[model samples]
Target: MPFRPDPSLPVPPAGADPLPLQGLTLLLVDDSRFTCDALRLILHRAGARLRRAESLEIARLHLNCYRPDLAIIDLGLPDGRGEDLIAELSQMGFAVLGISGDPAGRDPALDAGAAAFLEKPLGSVAGLVRLIRQLTTGIGPVAKGEEVPVPAGDPMALRDDLARAARLILAPGDPAYARGFVQSLARASGDASLEAAVRDSGTPFDRARVARMIEDRLNRLRALA
Candidate 1:
């Protein structure tokens, strides 16, 4: 199918570089609003027009209306697995990048016909840009003028991550869920100690210890003026 662009989507900034992905449109299909926001920040700064759909149905709607140059799909969607969508988009000839928090999902994503598989929570925006450059144009940096200087730490995203940690700590339902959140949050916060604590936290006692650790860290972050 020939690519189509949505008129309602905002174009890249006027002064932005027109190389790399300057004229391309990207669709991100993921359930997490926070993650979609992060992708928007990264891709928009890198010169691509961004559109987001939070579920598989919403993504289908976007596909029916407008065809994007590329789509980044999250495997564990609320409604359905992203692998299915990747197969469909692949059949339709769009370059699809499959992303997942679970490491085991990578093979299935590639088997479903994704051009590449990425693990999340991503290390940095620069990694994302580099992946795009590698995927689209073989080998090169982000094409000079298209580079966006990513900060060492984004206070807002970190704050949201902390809030999530607090909630997970407070209402511990599934151990796997809590453990997964701890891993992702730890990565986002760049807290190696916490990451090790959570990774080693397998037994009930360990989980309780991690919960206290999370609570303490959250409290410290909250108390900061």
Candidate 2:
């Protein structure tokens, strides 16, 4: 389906082109529906088409069918690190943009050959558009003092992510993937307590505590629903 900008979301900078990315096709490799939902709005405003793959496996499957004009990869994935995919795609001459909720992910992503990197909770549509334009064309000049508006992800999507994490935390076996997933979500949502709980969780007791916290948040979100 074609992307359509949400009217309730922020508009681009006053002088910016409404359709700067027209005729462009983008592939987003990410797991979080929250992130995908937010990017959908941004891409729609910029007049771009989007296809999504939630993991490296899925992305490779997509690549086998067709190559997109650009690929925006999330540094963390459920199956593997996004940098590995970035290295392969960049070597293949694809324009790649790496994004992560963890600021520390920047260097590894860039070193892996991503054209550019953006920190997550990706607030600014104009900033993203500018970066995409520059990556594809090597030229995207922003007007002086223009205030690029920042759009937020859908709250329900966030709720869904938390709910999934809540389930993962309780599931038997190592919770490494869930921990990283929650860490990313915590950073994106500014949930410092949740972030700390997951980051410092090294023992069974700590893991149980983190599970409780996730469950509490999930319950609250369910209440709202």
* Best-matching candidate per lDDT: 2
Report RMSD for candidate 1: 6.1
Candidate-wise lDDT, in order? 0.70, 0.83
Q: Give the least accurate 10-residue stretch of model 2, judged by summed lDDT.
A: 141-150
Clashes of each: 0, 0
TM-score of every candidate relative to the true structure: 0.66, 0.90
After aligning candidate 1 to the native by TM-score, how far in Å is the CA of 220 from where it should be?
A: 3.3
lDDT of 1 by residue, 97-211 (tens): 9987667878999999999988766655556776786776576765343334343334555656666665664464765655666665575456788888888977777767877
Clash pairs for candidate 1: none
Assess candidate 1 and give its TM-score to the true structure.
0.66
* Residue 34, model 1, lDDT: 50
